[model samples]
Target: MPIKESRMTQSQNVQLLAVKAQQALMAALRSGQLRDGQFLSMSQLVTMLGLPLSAVREAVKHASSLGLLVTMPKRGIQVMEARPETIRDCLDFRMVLDQEGARRRIANDDLTGLGALRDRHQAFREAALRGETGNTPDGPIEVDLSLHDFLAAGLGNAQLAAAYAANRMRTAIIQNARPFLQDRIISAMEEHLAIMDALERHDADAATGAIRLHYTQTLRWWGVT
Candidate 1:
């Protein structure tokens, strides 16, 4: 290969490794192997991620830039804290995106998939009430995340969508430290239904209001004021 091509290939390989390391970090987080505000050295991170030093270093840089980790001088990396400030910031960012997304979606009159989502939320809530599923059923969470993704896509902006996804992932990791508010699934489902209802009614103001209501409730649920 030419020198430039070789360098490009090496860079690509490093990028791939960095992505893999990031994935491993998320896996560790979801599997309870990692916790919020946990501190560990680069060597330990490499062991945890099972990635090479270079890859881990790149991953750390990327994750840190994404607000997922904090690196200390002469110290190891710290997982994102689950403090009130962190939760507030993450949710606030999401609230902005969601409000704008909802407005755009309402303006475009694009609410075709909302019915199914509302139905799913209802079903999940009903199941939770009946004690058929556990407190935090995976179905509702999937539907909830998908609903947000739907709203974000309505913006029709790839960059905004990407930012939303990144922020959402960070919030998810933070929530892992707290888990879904115990027994709050029903209210969350109801809130989602309200938002969908407003959308179906073509009430942009109501939709935005519902979104804000949900955000306030969520901040409360997270004990973030």
Candidate 2:
């Protein structure tokens, strides 16, 4: 291979490894293998992520950029702690994205997956009522994030979508520390259904209102005053 081509290949390979490392880090966070506010040395992070130092460094840079992790001089990396202020700020950013998404979704007259979304929320609601927590096909977290994910992606703005996804990982980190309250699952489902109803009716105002209401309840549930 030409020298330039070889260099390009090497760069591409590095990027791929870095991407995998970032994904592994995220998985570790989700699975509680890496807890919020936990600090780890460079070698420790490499061992936990099971990747080489170079790739882990890249991953750390990416994660740090997203505000998910912080690197301190001689103190190792610290995962973002889910304080009340942090929770409030994260939720506030997401609320703006969701509200805009709701308006855009209604304005575009898009109700393509409304039925399926409603079905999932309804199923969750019923399962919660029956005390069958494990019955939902995708579990409560997936069901809860579906509508918001849909609305956020519908905006067709790549940057905002990326920001939304990053904030989701932030949410996961917070949940890892304070886990979702099962008692609130039913209430969440009901709130989701209300938003879906508004979307199906093509009422932009109602949809945004429902989204706002859901956020309000969620903040309370998270104990964020």
Candidate 3:
């Protein structure tokens, strides 16, 4: 029984190790430590992740399946470009779900989550004011993906939450491109503040209008329209 338990524990450890390796790889790719076209050889992955080659292989396979990485035959793995179509799809889905969430929150008078969103927007504004790099702490794009995530969570919709989380990489891609438009970033910050203000007043119509305008303006800025 003790031996069997030890084997189970070892299996769990391996699983944990693989998960950590995958996360590390994702972080590296997202942060630009791993460029899109650069090949990630097994030896490199093993070295960077401090894992066995087999484990790195497994992790790469998993990440590739998630569209974060692509394995080239006889060339190893490379980071996948978060294409424009992927970005549009992610934003389109978010637009629909977030609009519905806004409507529901307003109807139900649920403003509890609005405060947190406001806070995050304020942080982003402050960061932009300081001319801080747009990448996340780990170097991925630092857009306000968290705000949408917070909204989905507050709406208590598991499917929406899962979908949002799954599309994080694509959203990060759009954010990565945002720094090129410094003026637009400033405008977006003000827009977010306005949205928060409307929500605070429990003005459903105004809130919805503000959000719709914000998204429309974003699409225009990105030339997505």
Candidate 3 lDDT tens digits, 1-225: 699999999999889888888888777765666654466677877898787776688888987776767888887777666455655676777766666777777677777766766776677677667777454343213445555654565566777666666566645545554444445666777777777787678787887788778778777776776
lDDT of 3 at 225: 62
**What do the candidate models score in CA lDDT, each in turn?**
0.81, 0.86, 0.68
Task: Give the 10-residue window scoring lowest on summed lDDT in candidate 3.
Answer: 135-144
| Candidates, ranked, TM-score | 2, 1, 3
All-Cα superposition RMSD per candidate: 2.4, 2.1, 3.4
Task: Order the numbered candidates by lDDT, best leading.
Answer: 2, 1, 3
Give per-model TM-scores: 0.88, 0.92, 0.78
RMSD (Cα, Å) of candidate 1? 2.4
Tens-digit per-residue lDDT, 67-177, candidate 2: 999999898999999999999998888888988988888888867888988987898789888888763323777778888898897777999999999999897787677
How many collisions per candidate? 0, 0, 0
Looking at candidate 1, the ten consecutive residues that score lowest on lDDT are: 132-141
TM-score of 3: 0.78
lDDT of 3 at 167: 64
